[model samples]
Target: MEIGLVGKPNVGKSTFFSAATRLEVEMASYPFTTIDANKGVGYIRNRCPHQDLEVECEPNNAPCINGTRMIPVKIIDVAGLVPEAHKGKGLGNQFLDDLRQASTLIHIVDASGSTNSEGEPCGKGEHDPRADVEFLTKEIDHWLKGILERNWDKVSRKLEVVGGNVEHAVYEQLSGLGVSEAMVVLAVRSADIQESPKNWSGDDLYRLAKAIRMKAKPMLISANKADLAGDDLMDSLMTLGDDIVIPTSAEYELALRKASESDIVEYMPGEDNFKVLRDDISDMQKSALDKIESHMKRYGGLGVQQTLEKAIYELLDMIVVYPVENEHSYTDKDGRILPDAHLLPRGSTAEDLAYAVHTDIGKGFIRAIDSRTDRVIGRDHELKDGDVIKIVSK
Candidate 1:
């Protein structure tokens, strides 16, 4: 699954991306510093199952770092969103299109309220972060709505005469956005607009649009630049949703990672604290590290990790499974132990994992063995998180 970093300009989306992926991108104080989307492999931290089995795991594709499985995922840093972007302003269409494949969005909000509506520098608390959250959601809705509306006449007219489903028509319109027909159907049903396709009003279309956007592009607000934010600013943002707001200091995360690279500090990607390896650091650098430490102590690790975890596991309901040829040794054909850990939907079955491993194995149509229990199981057996399965193909 892909997670897209989105927000107004200068809200540190690039910094967040750099910290999370360590991909060097141009970060500037002005708007639209990222003209195109930058994609890199980020990771989700999972407790490696090898620790429970009392064995040392030598993973190949997904590495285990100190008992934490680093499962790689695609992360995107996209161009900032401006008002009326759906109206083709400020490379808006390009930015929105960059998010076409994203499973979820991390809205990098300037929690300190430092940037204005146009992404220009402003007072620390002048901008309402609540507005920042809503504006991005609305912009995405507008973008989807525009796509649906542009083809409405042809689609609705065809649906009327051909007796085609409204959801399918809308889904086809938004096919480029990776929207599913089931998602569109649910969105239309949730909006409670029972009108026929040809009779759908602009408001009806918008309601459907909003619902589709909510389902297809669900977002979590990464309360970014939290170092400069006050209590009131945080409280107001918390009021938006208890679990949705993750206070993040992208700048601090970047600093910690950079320090780790420089051998001045020993750090883990998602650890709450770090070890200062050397005492020769300058006083200014020491002060900055202190502030970052304070942020970590308060918020529980750099929020970048938590944000990605939430997007994949919580929002997307994905679970990790180890598909090995030899379940006993947890090795692939080449004898690489725990070589592949595939992320599948929570309810995915053993056969689903077989398909994820190889199409030929899935088509062979055979049972699977659960390594944990060493029990023979059918294709329909639902796989759980950290399940190690050996497919018995024909």
Candidate 2:
């Protein structure tokens, strides 16, 4: 699954991306610093099952760091969005298109209110960060509504004549956005639009579109630049009901990672503290590290990693499963122990895992074996998190 990093320009969205993925991108203090989308591989942390099974892991797909499995997930840093983006203003079309494949979005807001509606630099607290959250949602909602409204009269008439399924028809319009028919059905149910598509009003379509966006592209808020924010701003963002807002300092996180890369500090992503490895560091560097530590102490570590974890594990409801060729040894064909880690949605079955592994393997339609229990499980058997299973295909 891919996660899209979206925000108004100059809010450190690129910084967040660099911090999370350790990939460099152009960053500046002005709007539209990122014109094209930057795609990189980020990771979701999971406990390595090798630890429980007491075996050395020779991981292939995901790396093991200190008994933690870092499963790779694609992250897209799209161009910054502005108000009325759906109306084709300020790289709006580019941003929307870039996010079509995103399973979820991380809205990075300038919690310090240092960026204005146009994403231009402003005095701290000059703009209401809450407006940033609300506007982005509305922009996406309107964009979806626009797509649904196109050729509505003709499409609805055809559907009415054929007595077609509204949910399926809507899904066809939004499938490009990675929206499933099941999600469309749920959105329709939530919308409660009683009228047939042919007679549905604009408001009805818009409500349905909003519901669909909510399901299809659920978002988590990264209240960035937290070091420059006040308690009032942070509290206000936190109280935005139903939105998961995490205080983050993308600048500080990037700094720490850069330090780690240079071996100046011993640090890991998601760690609450870091060790300064060198004592002969310049006073300027020491001062910067001291401030970051204080900030970490105040807000419980840099929220970049925490926000990614929440987006994948919480919003996406995903679990990591180990697929091995040998259930007994948790090894693959090359004899690499615990070779691969796959992230599947909660309640995914053994069959789904087979398909995830390979289409031919799934088509063979055989049973699977649970390595932990040494129990033979049918294709439909539900797999749990950290499951090490070997498919017995023909």
Candidate 3:
């Protein structure tokens, strides 16, 4: 699944991307630092594959190899959006097209309101971050509405043959928007469309548009620059009733990761603080690093790691399942233990997972054995997190 990182200009999109993937992109304190989309792999740490192996290690050091299983979720840092992005303003068509293929969007908001829509510094009291969210969401909804409006005549004609069901017509028209057939059915049902086209109001059209958007519309609010925003901002955000707001300091986290590589300070990305391993660094440098590190821990998480993972698993409801052969060794064809891990959608059955593994495995139509529990299950067995399954095919 691909997730697009989008927001108004200079809302730390590039910083979030850099921190999440550890790739260096041109991050400036200005708008449109990322004009083109930068794609990278962001990894989450699952329970160690060798955890059940009972290998011993020191505190803060696990015995398992630190290699991450790359599930290949494309993260696109698209160009910034302005108030009128839907109306061909501020690289309008380009930005929307970039996000057209994304399964979901992660809106990186400047909770501190340090920057304006143009990524310019404004007076402290003049910034309204909530307006940014409203504006961007409106643009997306309007853009989809425009697409539907343009094709309304053709779609309306098709409805006559399909029993005059506007929902079916709308789904047939919007199949290119990366919405799945099942999700389209849900969107149509939730839209409450009528049999007669004359009864459909502009509001109905808008609601239909919004539902299509929501099909791929799982968005996580990244309350960025939390260190600068303070507790009141976080408390205020929590009170707003958004379930997936994650406080993050992207810049500080990237710097800390850089520091770790240099061996100046031993720091984990999400840690509240760091341990100073060497005294050779200047006191001024150490103090600067310590301030950023401390800010990260108190507010929420250091980099975008915690935020991205929370968005993927908790907000998106995804689960990772390991497909392996050897129950004792937990190895794949290349003898690498749990080398291939598939992140499947929630409520995915064993048959669905079999298709993800390979068509042959799925076509054989057999059962699966949960290696962790040594329990055999049918093709329709529902999978949970961290499940290791051995497919028993014909």
lDDT (CA) per prediction? 0.84, 0.90, 0.71
Off by over 4 Å in 2: 23-37
Candidate with the larger lDDT of 1 and 2 = 2
lDDT of 2 at 227: 95
TM-score winner, 1 or 3: 1
TM-score, model 2 to reference: 0.95
Please give the lDDT score at residue 94 for candidate 1: 74
Please report the candidate that would top lDDT against the real structure.
2
**TM-score of candidate 3 to 2 decimals:** 0.88
TM-scores for all candidates: the values are: 0.94, 0.95, 0.88
What digit string (tens of lDDT, one per residue) describes model 3 on residues 33-65?
233447766655566545665432121111122
Q: Write the per-residue lDDT of candidate 1 for residues 126-224, one digit (tens) a residue.
A: 999889887888899887877888989888898878886677778888887878888888998899987777888888888889999888988888998
Which segments of model 1 are wrong by more than 4 Å? 23-37, 241-243
Q: Least accurate stretch of 10 residues (summed lDDT) in model 3?
A: 56-65
